[model samples]
Target: MSVKISLFISVIIIIVFSAGTFFLVSQQTSRLEDELLYRAKIQSVLGAETVATIIEEAIDNGVFSVNEAFDTDYQIFGNFDPPKYHTSYDSYLDRAILSIQDKFLKDDNLIYAVAADRNGYVPTHNTRYQQSITGDPEKDRVRNRTKGIFNDPVGIKAAENKEEGFQQIYHRDTGEVAWDVASPITVKGKHWGGFRVGVELSSISAAQTQLVKAMGLIMILILVVSLLFTFLYVTKAMAPLRKMTVVARNIAKGNELESEIPVTRKDEIGELQDALNRLRLSILIALKRKKGK
Candidate 1:
């Protein structure tokens, strides 16, 4: 076969293999993303249940009233707002929620573990967000929130639906992406609020990118090996054809046979070699008869 034909066949093989590899990698990455989201949702649901249980227990023990714990009225001081006070029961509940948040954060994938009341008031937040406000609006929005109101659409949706769902949010300042899953919190058969668990997707995205790059590298290596083997095999297989072409040219120029065509193959090449030998013998016999006459 011509070099061009050989190279074309190799290119086609490479294309087919590369396409298959790409499809498989894409599927694997998609599954991984789904698993990550699934785990996030489960965590959110569990956290919501735990918070609900704590609140219910506090109420049953008569340590705090449900109405008092969820009270929205803020006690305003004269000029400067004095530090807000929490009953011992409320403090106990807060510590329990904080402990849950800390445990979740240890996984590194979890971004936030928080619960909001029906009115979107977050009574407890992650330990990092529990820090005192530094008077920075942007920073305070993320941190320093015990009785802070978060009337965002996500919070309201979770409270209204009382079902587990997913959400995505982007931070413009940091260009951060957050994947959130929310589940409703119920206390004593009453809809209290919801618990939200957020996962930062930047790490997951980076991991996916790395996986794609690795797959691409493997494809390149396989392609190179395939091409190399194809080139060598094509060259070896066509060497006998090249020899036959040269022998035919000499016979056409009325030159004496220099060497017999090698018939080492048991395939079509061997058959062609036998036919050429017979033709050469017939020509020699005809020339002898003409000379004798």
Candidate 2:
């Protein structure tokens, strides 16, 4: 009886605790994602605005021609894996866009900071991704990616979004997921491409994995502790019943004064104890009357 009751209660403990643990994990995961995305949007807007201001200043000072910077017609330059392209306007942005990206790359979560034109032409990229190509298709695709058109579905949405900040997620060629938040870059009220800030969620993913493991460890402890507690409690609770079983067996064998049943509890077990005491008293009284007669 003790073993059966302990096992049953332990199962209930697992079910209840499992449900609560998973709910907490799901909520926490969602909160982490929301916070990460919020920060991404802020970074995108700030970076985009900063780069746009730099472009306008250079144009105003006559450092670079605005005509070349906004050129829609591009020329393909290299027969590389991504097909590198060139435009007359790309030279003006080559040097001006690097400083702002350097500042944004200080944060560990930030993967890349770059701006693309309306046609998804990237004149410049972060230096980290601008290493010299090694003539390997797979390697060059991830590294040394510059002067290329990023007109993929997600890239097109980012480059063409002229209204406000927007966010999207995609897998990088480096086998990691990134959250890309973009804000349109307008130069002197003219629409340029958009600036994108990429956020790598590896840290958040690591934290969530740790949380799940900790929860699993907690559940194991609960199971162990609960089973131990239930076993001890059921054993202690059923002790009196076991003793009464022996006493009732003795009484049935005509050992009239074998022992007295104590009514200690007010529950059904106590009622059984009281009934046994009454039966014992009735037997003793009948024996006394027979002796006198």
Candidate 3:
């Protein structure tokens, strides 16, 4: 019975400890993901703002002024014609995208990069855009559509006059993903275009998997240690009871009551030992009286 009780207590303790460890590990992983996402959003917004400022400065300095260049007099910044201007503009855009992508790459978890203008034109991609561009309905829609951020599939309410922000978007191929941030580079309060920074959802999941693996290892270690300690504790606790069991069996077999039981505790076990010794003395005294008669 005592062995059963000890086993029960040990099991409960193991379970409780394991549960707490799992919870703590899970919380830590979630917190890390949130922190990384927050940092990504801030970094994306900063990159967009920097790009926007550069463009605005270019406008001021006649690098590529708004009206004379695009010829699309729509009061909105549109395609810059002439190979030179596009080349220069694309060069600047590429540098910014590359910088952000390098930063993401430096972090081991992040895998891909995508930045689109408000027009959703693919500005920068680590992968060959044509390779992934399957001739599918979704791709067709993306190619045809002109505006709206599509990465964070869920609509994160675009900030009022947002120069930069962040959201999550989903790809039909991959569902429920996270984006670090997406920001619009605005000039003169008109929506020129935007840049988006994306961090793969796989990054978060990968981290979570690593954490779970680590926790499992720790739990195994704990269980092994606990098992050893429980065995030692139970053996020590039941030692006196084992001895008492042997003493009772010998008396039932009508053996001489000369053997002594050791009393090492003041608890119930000790009291039982004292009672057995007194009973042994009484039986010996009765035997002597019987011999005299």
Candidate 4:
């Protein structure tokens, strides 16, 4: 057909492909977010339970006290030395706990840890917790939340079930959320308090965002390649049409119309070229008749 019509079809194909790509990308983003959030929540719970079991074992053997190991003056895990008077068991247990904390830090999702008495007193924590909760307020909040066995869900659950763990979502800061995991510290069937761990949503959210951006870049690259190919295809298809235009222009300028359009495909453009050839023959016949007259 005409060049204008061919270009219109190409534009329509491009639009349809673009819309399909956008919809697929949007669905992929949603699925990724949902799966990441669910996995983050489950991972937080597993981490808290695992660490609590280690602490409970140590406590059972009388190796360490919740208060002594995590006191302000005592730093167990990173670069800090264990107390000189600590028993061999204490040192082993402290090292184990520090190793767990180090692993949590390495994971991008982890946020905080809370070890409190039946009362919600902040005990041991990770770096994110230290940054989020302020000095005395952090302690007071924990204490207050644990005062009435009813105040803290994790506290009460741990106290009641004497189980290893519980998980929940906590709004730690305005417009920010964390997945909290807590496990009971029971020594010889007696629950002393519990251990809590918090995994921030931001880490997972940021990862998802980065993934979407990378996918977007890939889509843009594909579109660019498709556009390049389409331009090439259109240019090739229009070559015969351009030849026809030159022949018509020559005929208009009183030059001989000897060249035939070379388009062989039986499409609308081919049909139009054939009609032009017929019209040229009719014009030549009229010129011969007038010359004889």
Candidate 5:
């Protein structure tokens, strides 16, 4: 019975500890993900503001006319089949935007930093994508200049709303999970376009997985240690009761009492041992009286 009770208690302890450990790990993971998303949003908005400032400065310096530049209509080819831009006119703003995007891409998590006109025309993209295509379908799809139209839901939302927003989206070019953030680009009080920054989620997910595994291993180790100590302590503590059981059984079977049970400490187990000794003494007295008669 004592063994059963000990085992039950150990099981409960294991359950409780496991639940608490899981909750703690879950909370930590949630916090980490939130922090990562927050940082991505900040970076995206900052990039947008920086690009907007550059365009505004160019306008002030008489480098470009906001009305002509923003309203320029570029032709789209392929009839929405991975639509490509067919334009002979290039703006000096393209070089500046590409340069800023290149700096933003230095961060490993940042997948792309791009800008598009209000009409969803991309004049320039990251240098890697701007490089001449090499006939690889995957490479050409992302690298070709014609592939840069900001017509996706997130981009269109940014352009239409003219405000900053964020969404979890898959990259159209690479199909990777990412946090897509967009901030409006206004030049000289005109809604020129939006700046978008895509931050990949794979790194954050990998870190979370590694953390959970580590925490799980630690929890398992703690459980093993706890169970070991509980088992040993329960066994040792029940030794007195086991011995008393044996003595009581012998006395009832008319067998000789070989030794006295000792009550070493003032605990419940000691009290039990004392009670069993009194019963043993009474039995011996009764047997002696019967024999004399």
Candidate 6:
């Protein structure tokens, strides 16, 4: 009976521990993901505002020809597979906008921050993505992807976004899943393109994984402690009952020697102890009267 009670209490503790651990882990993971997403949104918006200012300065300084940009447009001029584009405006981006893009890349969780024209053409990617071409299509796709048009669903949506902000989760050209936040970039009240900040999901997943492991360890510790406490408590509570069992056996065998069942507790177990003591005294008296007669 004591073992049964201990087992029941241990099961309850395990249920509570499991539920609490799951809730805590889920809540922490959600908070962290929200924080990362918020940072990504801010970086994109701020980056867009800065890049727009730089483009306006270049146009004013005659470094970027606005009319030539509108006329030449995003036309393919190079012979490389996946090709390079021209709008008479890309060179200025390399000189003026690349630094701003690189600055946003320094923020945690962000993989790439770049500006693309309305037609989904990236003028100048960050220095890290501008690796020299190795001519293998597979290698070039991963290494030298600059001057390429990102026409995929997520890319096109970000490039043409005109709202205060736009967000999406999609696969990157480098084949990693990421969260993208984009803000429109305009010059002299005319929409030029959009600026995007890409946050890598692996970074967020790694943090969540570590958090779960820590929580799991804590839950295991708590469970072990609770089980030990249940075992000790049940054993102590059943000690008096075990002793009463031996006293009852001695009375049934008509043994001349029997120990008194004295109990300190005032609960049901103590009541049973008092009743058993009175019965033993009555039987001893009745036997003595019979022998005298």
Per-residue lDDT of candidate 1, residues 1-293 (tens digit): 65976789798988898888889789979987888889888888888888888888878888778776565565432221223333334456676678876787776777777877776666666788677767666676556555555566755665555777555553423245677678888877878778877778887887788888888888889888988888888888888888877777777764655456667778988887888777677777777888999
Query: lDDT at 182 for candidate 4?
Result: 63
For each of the candidates, the C-alpha root-mean-square deviation to the true structure, in angstroms, is: 3.4, 3.2, 5.7, 7.8, 3.2, 2.5
Using TM-score as the measure, which candidate wins?
Answer: 6
Model 5, 180-219: lDDT tens per residue?
Answer: 7777777778787777777778977888899899899998
| Candidate 5: stretches off by over 4 Å | 1-3, 68-71, 75-91, 136-138, 145-147, 171-173, 253-258
Clashes of each: 0, 1, 5, 2, 0, 0
Cα deviation at 222, candidate 2, in Å, is: 3.2
Better of 1 and 4 by lDDT: 1
lDDT of each: 0.72, 0.82, 0.58, 0.56, 0.73, 0.83
Colliding residue pairs in candidate 5: none
TM-scores across all candidates? 0.84, 0.82, 0.73, 0.63, 0.84, 0.87
What is the model-wide C-alpha lDDT for candidate 1?
A: 0.72
Off by over 4 Å in 6: 65-72, 75-77, 255-259
**For residues 1-293, what per-residue lDDT tens digits would candidate 3 score against the true structure?**
66786788788888988888878897889897778777766766766666667667766787666643222222323332110112224445455455654555555544444444443444444432223323465553333222223333332322222545546554423343655466666665676555555667777788888888888888789887887788788888888888888787776665757766566679999999988777777777787899999
Poorly placed runs, candidate 3 (over 4 Å): 1-3, 66-88, 95-101, 112-115, 122-165, 172-180, 188-190, 260-262
Candidate number that wins on lDDT, 1 or 6? 6
> After aligning candidate 6 to the native by TM-score, how far in Å is the CA of 109 from where it should be?
2.4
Give per-residue CA lDDT, model 4, range 100-161, as digits (tens). Answer: 65465665566544444454433443433323223355353342221112235644554344
Per-residue lDDT over 1-293 for candidate 6, one digit per residue giving the tens place of the 0 to 100 score: 88999999998998999999999999999998988888888888898899888878877888856765443357787577788887687877788878878888787688889988777788888888888877787787777777878888998899889975588997976689998889998878878778888888999999899999998998898899889988999999898998788787787776643466676679988888888787787777887898999
